[model samples]
Target: MSEKDQRIQTGKFGEDAACDYLIEADYKIVERNWRCRSGEIDIIADDAGRLVFIEVRTRKTGGRFGTAAESVDRRKQQQVRDTAQVYLRSIGCSAESIRFDVIAITMSRQMDSILEYKHYEGAF
Candidate 1:
């Protein structure tokens, strides 16, 4: 596969893992891969009555680049927040009912296995 295809596949895997993790943690999965002209949200779930907008970042464990969470910079956070706002407006929900979260998945490059799942709440 091409490099871009590999990246996309890896991202899909990470999103799947994140959804499972959230479900295991008692979070109800409301949506996945919600997108608009502005941006995309990897996951949208309900966490104990609070609307949660989640961003999933995945990277190979011990990669030279950086940790998955570290990939989410200020500009990315702003984009997520903006997308979340559009989502809320479409659903007729108040922004007060929502929270931003990040799920970082690290994969072992050697075995292509998930090494860790880190959940960051209220990340933005």
Candidate 2:
């Protein structure tokens, strides 16, 4: 596989892993890869009656870029917020008690091995 293909595969694997982790943590997944004109949301779930908008970032190596959570900058946060707004409007959900979360998946050399996962609640 090409480098790009490998990276894509890694990302998909990481997203799947993150979904599994969320499910294990008792999060009810409402959607995945939700897109609007503003931006895209990787995962949408409900955590104990609170709507959670999750951004999943996966990295094979975390040396230069730090962790996945750090990858979400201000612009990215704004995009997520916009996307979440669209989602809420489309689903007729009240924006009262919503939260933004970042799920960082770090992979090891083995590809299948999860080196670390950090879940940042209310990241934005």
Measured by TM-score, the strongest candidate is 1
After superposition, which runs of candidate 2 have C-alpha atoms over 4 Å from their true positions?
Answer: none
Query: Which tens-of-lDDT digit does each residue in 1-124 have in candidate 2?
Result: 9989987898789889989999999999999999989989999999999999999999876457677778899999999999899999999988999999999988986686888889999888
Task: Compute the lDDT for candidate 1.
Answer: 0.92
- Residue-wise C-alpha lDDT for candidate 1, range 11-108, written one tens digit per residue: 99999989989999999999999999899999999999999999999897777878999999999999998999899999998888789999999988
Position 85, candidate 1: lDDT: 89
TM-score: model 2 vs. ground truth? 0.92
Root-mean-square deviation of candidate 2: 1.3
Error of 1 at 119 (Å): 0.2
lDDT of 2 at 111: 84
Model 1 stretches with alpha carbons more than 4 Å out:
none
> Model-by-model lDDT, in order?
0.92, 0.90
Stretch of 10 with least lDDT, candidate 2: 60-69
Candidate 1 clashing pairs? none
